[model samples]
Target chain A: MFGKKRVAIVGAGVTLFRRNLKETGKELSYEAAKTALEVAGLELRDIKSVVMGSAPDAFDGVHMKGEYLADGAGAYHKPYTRVFVGGGTGVFTPLAGWWHVASGQFDTCLVVCEEKMSSCYPHPQYAFTTIFDPILERPIGMNLIWIFALEMNRYMHKHNIKKEDIALVSVKNKRNALDNPIAQLAANITVEDVLNSEIMAWPVQRLDVSPTSDGAAAVVLASEDVAKEVTDNPVWIDGVGWCIDSTHWTDRDLYYPDYVECAAKMAYKMAGIKNPPKEIDLAEPYDPFDYKELHHMEGLLLCKKGEAPKLTREGVTQRDGDLPTCPSGGLLGCGNPIAAAGLMKVCEIFWQLRGEAGKRQIPGDPRTGVAQAWGDLMQYGSVIVLRR
Target chain B: MRYYQSEAVETKDIKEGKIPTEKFRPKAKFAWSAGIAISRFLEELKNGKIIATTCSKCGRIMVPPRIYCEKCFKPADGWKYVKDTGVINTFSVSFLAADASRLKEPIVVAIINLDGASEGMGIVHRIEEYGDWREVKIGMKVKAVWKPPEERTGAITDIAYFKPIRE
Candidate 1:
C-alpha cells in the first residue's frame, strides 16, 4: 500500500562480523554490495540510486564518511544519499531505498550499511564518549554501558524482574548463534554463565552486552515490476516506520520504551496488521542488550508490558515456538557492528521469509516477519515489515 | 548463504606494522557553546545556585535549562531556582571507565530529579560519599555538593557530586 509503486527487497548480503576486520570500510561495503547485486542477478549499472548508512564519523575516524564510501557502495556516478539515526540507520537506510523506488524516481536502489568500530583507538567505546553533552554529561565521564545499566535497573525494578530472567536471553541468543555461520560470539552457555560474567556496570554484565564489531550489510530494493523480473522469491516491503524520542533521555522514564511502540504502531497500521502478536509470524527486534529484546517486544505490542519475560520463560520465542524472535542470533550472538547489525536483522527476515535461513530457519511456514532497530541515545526506533 | 566474507585482524598486526596501516591521531578540539539557556545555568552554578526554565504553556519546569520549551515549541516563560536537594530517579554502579578500562573505585552515577523542577526533570551526575553502591537506591533523597567558590568554574562540574542526605 505504498502509493502507486510498491518496493520489494529482491536481494540482500552481509559480511562476517568480527572484533577487528582487516578490510577497510570501503572494502566491506563493496563485499556486501557486490553480493547483493549478484544475488539479485543485477549489475552495479542497474542501480538507479544509492543509500548509505553508517553510525558515527568518529567510529570510522573520517569526516564525510558517506562520500568516502560511495564508490564501495556502488554509488559511483549515481544519485546517492546517506542516512544517519545513530543505530537506527541500518533499517532506516532501506526505508530511504523504499522511497527512491516508491516515489517512482528510481526503479532500483542499493542500500548499504557499514561500520568499522574497531578502528577507534584504545577501545571503540571511547568513540561513544563524544555522544554525550560536551558541557554537562561528558564531564561525568560516562561509559555507554552506564546508560544501559541505568535503564536495565529501572526496567527490572518496575517489573520486579530478576537478573536470572534477563540472563536467559544471553543463553538463548548465543546458543542460537551456534547455528549461524557468520556468528561471532556463538556458544552454548547457561544463564549462570551470564550472571557470573564480568560486570561492566551493575545490572549490565559483559555477556549481557554485544561485542563491538566491524562489518557491512547491503540490500537491493526495486519496484514491483523490477522485482518480478529479478527473483522468484521477492520479499515485499509492506510497511516501514521510524520514530525518534526527545534527546533528554535522562528526563524520561527508562522503565519502558515508548518510542519503539510509536514506530511499531505506524508500521503495523500501514501493513494492516490488527494483532501484531498473531499476524507477524516472526520478529527480529534489536537485541544489543539481552533485556532490549523483551523491552522492544512490549514496545512493538507483540506482548503486553511486563509480559515478555514470562513469554521468554515459557520458551515461546524459541525458533520452533509460537513466535520465534531473533532466530538469526541477533546482535548479542551475531556481532554488533552498529549500522551493520541493524541491517543484519533486516537481512535475516528477508532470508527467513525466503526459506533460505538453512539451519537457523524456523520450522513452520513463516510468511510475514518484522525487523526493528533502536538507536540514537535510546530514543530512536526503525521498523520494517516484510512479506514473502 | 555461504558467501559471507571477512578477515579478522589482531592488535599485534597493527601494532607491529604487519598490517601496513597508517595510524592517525586527530587533535580536533572544540569549544562547545553552552548556548542561551545553559550559559545562564552554568553562571548560576558558579554562584552556588541551581536554575531551571519554566514553560508556562506546558506548565513544566525543566533542568539544564533551555531557551525554548521543547514540548510547547515556544520560548520558556522564565527561569526559576530549583532546590539543590532531590530524589534519585535511577542509578548505576560503573566499574569501567569511559575507554572500557577497569577503575579501582567504581563510580556511582544517578539521575537526580531536582526538588522544584517538573516531575522526571533530572540531571545526570555522579553520586559519591556512599559506603557502597547498593546503598544508592531510587527515590533516595540526595543533595548536590558544590566545589569551593574560589575553585568554582562556570560548568556542570561546579557541583562536585551529589551525596546522600543523611537523616
Candidate 2:
C-alpha cells in the first residue's frame, strides 16, 4: 500500500436537505456542484472527470439514472463513472472519485451525490420494495421498516440495552444539529418523546427514522501536487474501502453490521490506523436509523464489540465528549437523502479537519477522522479515512 | 371442450381435499429526478423535438443526454437536437401491464436506441399500433407520434408510442 496515491478533498458543498425540492435533480446537482467548485476554486470546466452515485434508479423514478445525472454532475465531457452501493453511494461517490485521482490518472474530479425521495408517491418507503428479489422477497410483502425493527430488536436483546439508552442518540444528535445550517430534523427532545412516538413496525419508532429528503452534496478532489497550490488545508483521503455481504439478509446477525468490520479493517490497514477507538478523533458512521450509528461504531472498532450503546448512553459520542461522532447532526438529525446524506457525512469530516465547520466543529484539534456508509439490502459498509 | 366444466366442478367438490394458499402483489411507484440533460431532452421530446448530449472527451452522441460520458472524464460540450426517429434495439410482448391486470390485447414492449445515440443507449417504450407481437421485430424502423398540445403532460407517455413510419 506504500505506492498508494494520495487523494485530497479540497472542497465540499451541499444543497438544503429537505423533503421536497422545486428544482429537479439536475438543478439540485448544479446548486451543489457550483458551491463545491467555488470552495475548490475551480469551475465545471476545471473538473477532469466526474464520479456520480445515487442509491437506485427506482428512487429517482428514472431509468438509466446514472447517465441521467451525468451532466448535472458536470460529467458530460469528462471521464464520468457512476458507482452505487445502496445508501453507501454517498460515501462511495468520493471513493469513486478517490480512485480516479489515486490511480495516477485524473487531476480534478467532481464527486456529486443526490437523492429526491419525495417523488415516490404514497410514501418513500414504497421504493424499498424494488430493492428485494422480484421472485422470492417480494412474495413476502417485505417493507424496509421491518428489517430495521428486527435489527433494533436484536440489538436490544444482545446488549441488554434498554429502549431509553438508545433514545439518547436521537436526542443528542438532534440537539447537536441545531447549529447545523442544512439540518432537517434538528430539534430538542427528551427520551420520553422518542418512546411516545408512533411505532411503525415495533421497536422501530417513526421518530427513530431519518426524514425522507431531497438533497445533493458535491466534493472536489485533486492530487496532492495540485491541491497544495489551491489550498493549504488539504484533507487527505488516507484510505478508502468498501465490502458487501451475501444477499440472504435474513440469515445474518441483525445485531451488527458485519460488513463494516471488514471494510473498516481494509481502510484502517491502508491508513495505518492501529487503534481506532483511540486513534480516530471523530466519525460520522451512517445513522439512517439511530441504532445503526451505534452498530457502525462497533464495526469501525471505535470501541470493543457491543460497547457502542454504553458509549452512546454515557455521552462519550457527543460533540463535547471523547470521540465526537456525527457532530454535523447526522442523517437522523439533518436528513437522509440517500447518497447526498452519506456525502454530507464526508463533508462534515472535511469541515472538522479544517476547523471551518463553524458552530458544528468538534472541540479538539481533530487530525484523524473516518466516515462510513452502509446500505444495499443491508449488507454493505463503505468506509473512508481522512487525515489533516 | 364444452362438456367438461360442469362434471369436473361436481367431481372436484367430491375429491379428498384442497389446501389454502396465498399470493402477494405490491404496487410499486417511484419518483425520479430526470437531471439536466435528460430532463431537457424529455422536454424537447414533448415539443416534437429530439436532443442528445455529446461527450466532447469522447465523441458519443447520446440520446436521452447524459451529464457524464461514463467513458471520458470531463464535462460534456456538444448539444445536438434532431428529428425523432430510431431503430428498435430489443423488444418483448408484455402480457400484463404495471397493475398486473390483463389487457384486451398484448402490447409490444421495446427498447429503441435512437439512430444517433451511442452503443446500446436508448429509451424503453411501447411500439404503438404494431397490431400484435408477431408484427414487430428487432431493427424495425419507427418514429415518434406526438399527442395533441392540449393533451401534453411532462412525462414519457406524452408521445403515445413509436409506430412504423411510412418509409
Candidate 3:
C-alpha cells in the first residue's frame, strides 16, 4: 500500500533467548542495537530515527519503559516511538521503521525489541493478570493457560484433531531449536513426550507452551539509496499489515483467527501475492502454543482450515520441506520473549534469505518469506513480508 | 556476525544473591469506574439477573453490557435480561492458580453463551457439580447457581458458578 520510497532491512541482530539474563532490559537492547549497527556498517550517529517494540511494561516492571530504554536503543536526541500490540510488537517495530523511511522523513531507522519477562516477581505469569478484563474476566481469577486451553479445546473439537497431532509441532520445533544457538528449550523429544508432559490445563501441557524468557532483537531499516550503500543484498520490506479484534474474546468463536486472516489479506494485497500457499517460499507464524502454530498457519492462508495438521504430518513444514516454516526454531523452539520472539522470526528470515543462517538455513535459496506475530487476548495479529 | 553472542545468568546465582538486585514493589492500585452499563449490570446481578445491552442497528446483545455498541459505534438501544441458562461454548480444567502455583484441586472454567444474548456472546465463569473433567462437553446446557440473596453482592462473583442443568 505504501507506494512511496522503498525501504529495505539492511541489518539484523538478536540476543540469546533465556530464562534470566543478568543484563537489564536497557542493556539487552543496547547489545542487540549495537550489533545491528555494526552489521549495517553504520554508527549510532547515522540513524535518524528509532522505533522500539516491547511487549509489556509489567514484564520489565518499569512504567513508561520505552523512555527508559530509549538511550540504549540508540534513540538519544532522535525521533523515537514505541509500538506495542502485545507479542505482535516485534514485527510491528520494523513496520513502524519502514514508515519512517518510506515517508521520506528518515533515511535510516533503528528498530529494537526487548522483553525482560523474568523481572515480574513470584512468577511472570502474574503480570498477565492485568491483561484480562478486570470486572468481567479477572474477577473469576483467570490465568493465561485457561484461555489457551479453552481455545485449543474449541479448535480440536471443531476439527476432530487429536492432541497427539498437535504435539507434533512441539516435537518438531524443539528438535529444530537444538540447532539454534540462542534457543532456550531446544530438545530432541518425541510426540509421546509432549503428550505425557505435565498438564497445565487440559489439552495444553507444559511442553506445548513456549517458555517465558528474557531477550532482545534489533534490525536496521534504510531507504533504497542507503540500503544500496550499506549492503549488496538487502531484504526488501514488501508488505506490512496488522489487525486487532474485539477485546470481548468470549463474544467470538475461537476456532479460527479472523483477525489474523484480515491482517494477512491486507499484507498479501500490498505485497501483490495472489496465492500465499503457492507463492510464499517459507513462513514463521506465531506459535506461543503448539496448536497456535497450526491455527495461525490456517489464518495466514498458508494452508486450508483444519488441514495444517495433515500438511504437518506430511512434513510439509519441516526445514527441508517444500515450504519450510519456522526454520529459526520459532518461539516454541527458540524461546518466546514476546516482542523479541517476533523480531527473531524477522531476523531468521533475513539470515535465511541471505544464505547466512548456517546450521538452521533451509536447503533451498528461498526468495520470499512471511513472519507473523499474535497476542492480546487472541485479538491482534501483525504480519510482514520480506523479499530478497 | 557469526561471533555474536548474548550473556546469560543462572537462576541459582540470582537466588543465592550473587547478583546485586534491587527490589521495588508497586503500590499503585486502580479503582475503575464500571460506568453506566456495567454498574447497572452489576446491580442486576445482585438481583439474580443476567443483563445484556442490545444495539438496535446491529442487533447484537452484548454480555458484560456496554454503553456503546462496539460494532455499530452507537449508543446501545436498551438493556435486556438474558436467561440464567446457557450452553458451554468452551471450557478448561485448570490445575494452576492465578499466581502460577499448583492447585490442590483443578477448577473447571467455561465461557457460557446465554440463551437470550446474541450468538457467541457469553460470560467467563467457573463450572461446578461435575466430578469428572471429561464429562464437561461443549454445548452442554448449564444454569447460573447464584449465591443466596443475603450473601449477594454487586459483583460478578455474586452468581457463584454455573452448573449443568438436569434433563
Candidate 4:
C-alpha cells in the first residue's frame, strides 16, 4: 500500500501480564525488544529507528516517560519517538514504525509498548480521576467505571440488548484465554457467573472489567526488500488508520462508536476491503470490557449495526467459528496494561497468521486479519490490517 | 517458538521494602482558569441560575457553555438561562469511589439533558431523593436541588443534586 516501500512485521514479542511485576517499565521494554530482535534475527545495530508507546505518565509516576524509556527500548543514541493516544498506543506504535519503513526512510524499525500500572500507589484507577475535566466532571467525583457504566447503560437502552447477551462476550474471551500461556484472567466462566458477579456500577459487573496490569510488547517492522531478506514468511502490514472524535464525549450519543467506524473505513479503503465480514478472515478489536468487543466489531464493519451480539450468541466469533475474533483471549481474559495490551493483540494476529499460535490457532489457514484499539475519553480508535 | 517472561511480585514484597520500591505522593496541584464561556456559566450558578451558550452557526444551545461551537467551528453568538429541570439521559448506581474503595452508600450519577438546551446536550450530576436505583429510568424527569445562595460557590456543586420532579 506504499508508493516507496511496503512495510512488513518480521517479529513480535509479549511479556506476561500480571498485577505486580518485579521488572520496571524500562526492564519490561528491554525484555520484549530483545525478544523481538532475536526472533527477527536482527541486532540493535541493524535497527535504524525506534518507537515507544505508553499511556499516561501518572500511571508510572514518571514525567517524560518516552525519554525515560529510550535506552530500555533499544534507542540508545538512535532516532526514537514515543506515541501516546490513551489506550491506542499499542497498535499505534507499530503504525509509527510502519511510517519509517513505508516512507523508505529506514530499513528496519523497532517498536515497543509498555505499561506499569502496579507502580501507582493505593490503586491505578486513581490516576484516571485526572483524565476528567477539573471544572465540570471532576467535581462530580467520577470513578473511571462511571463513564463505562454510563456508556454501557446507554448502549443497552438504545439497542434493547439484554445483559445475558453482553455477558456472553466475557464467557467466550475468558475461555479462549485458557490456551494462552501469558493470560492473567483465563478461566472457565459462564454468563450466569458474569451476571452474578459483584457489581462495580449498576450495569458493570466485576467480571465485565479487565484488571489493571503491568507488561510490555514489541514488534519489528522492515521494508519489503529487508523483510524478504530477513524472514521467508513476513506478515505484511496491508493498511493502517486512526481517528479521534470531539473531546466533548458527553454531547455525543454513546450508543455506538462512530470514531471506530471512521477508522475502519479508512483502513478498509486502503486494504481494498469492500465487505469486511466477507473479506476479513479474523478480527481482534479491543475488549477492555465485555460489550466493547461487540461495539468495536460493529465499529470495524465486521457486522451490521447492533448485529454483533447476535453473532456472538450464535458462536460466530469463536476461534473455530467462521469469523474468529480475539483468539488471543483479548484484554478481558488477558491482562490489560493499557498500551502493552493493544500491542499484544497485534502480536496475537502475527502469531495466528504465521501458524505459531499452537493451541490457540484456528483450524483454517486465515490470510487476512485486523487489530484495533479504542482509547482517550472513549474518543479514539486505531486500526491495522495484516495479510500473509 | 519460545515467547513471554516476567517475575510476579506480591503486595508484601513492596510493603516490606523487599522489592526496592520508592514511594511518591504528588503535591503538584494547579488552580485552572474557568476560561471565557464557563467563567460566566459558573458566575450565573452563584446567582442560583443555570446558563447555556447558543451558536448562531449550528444553532445549538449547549450546556456547560463553551466559547466555540464544536460542530461549526465558530464562536458562540450569545447566552441564555436554561431551566434547572431535565430528564435523565443515562445513570449508574456506583458502589465504588474514585480510589477503587467500596463506598458505604452507593452514589447515583446521571447525565441530565437540561430543558432549554439543545437535544443531546447534557451535564453530569448526581441523582438523589430516591430510595433505590430501581426507581430511576433513562427518561425520568428531574429538577436541580440547588444549595442555599449563601452556601453556594461558583462551582458545579452549587446544585447539590438532581431529584425526581414527581416525588
Off by over 4 Å in 1: none
Give the total clashing residue pairs for model 3: 0
The sequence of per-residue lDDT tens digits that candidate 4 reaches over residues B1-167 is 33667998887888999889778798898999999988999999999999999998788999878988888989888998999999989899999998989987899999898999999887999999977778889989999999999999999999999999885
What TM-scores does chain A show, candidate by candidate in order? 0.99, 0.98, 0.99, 0.99
Q: Model 1 chain B: which ten-residue window has the lowest total lDDT? A: B1-10
Docking class of 1: medium
Tell me the TM-score of each prediction against the true structure: 0.98, 0.70, 0.99, 0.98
State the TM-score for model 3. 0.99
Candidate 3 yields a Cα-based lDDT of 0.91
lDDT of 4 by residue, A1-388 (tens): 5548999999998889998999999999999999999999999999999999999999988999999999999999899999999988888889889898888889999999999999887898889999999898899999999989998999899889999999999999999999998898999999999999998998999999999999999999999999999999899999889999987877878889999999889888888889999999899999999989999999999998889999999999999999989999999999899999999999999998999999999888999999999999989999999999
CA error at residue A13 for candidate 4, angstroms:
0.5
Interface RMSD, all candidates in order, equals 1.2, 26.8, 1.4, 1.1
- Model 2, residue A388: C-alpha shift (Å): 0.4
lDDT of 2 at B153: 61
- Checking candidate 3 for backbone clashes, the offending pairs are none
Best by DockQ: 4
Residue A165 of model 1, lDDT score? 88
* DockQ (model 1, Cα): 0.77
lDDT of 1 by residue, A70-119 (tens): 99999999999999999888889998888899999999999999999988
TM-score of chain B of each: 0.95, 0.75, 0.95, 0.95
Candidate 4: Cα lDDT at A25: 93
Q: Roughly what TM-score does model 1 have, to 2 decimal places?
A: 0.98
Give the DockQ (2 decimals) of all models.
0.77, 0.01, 0.72, 0.79
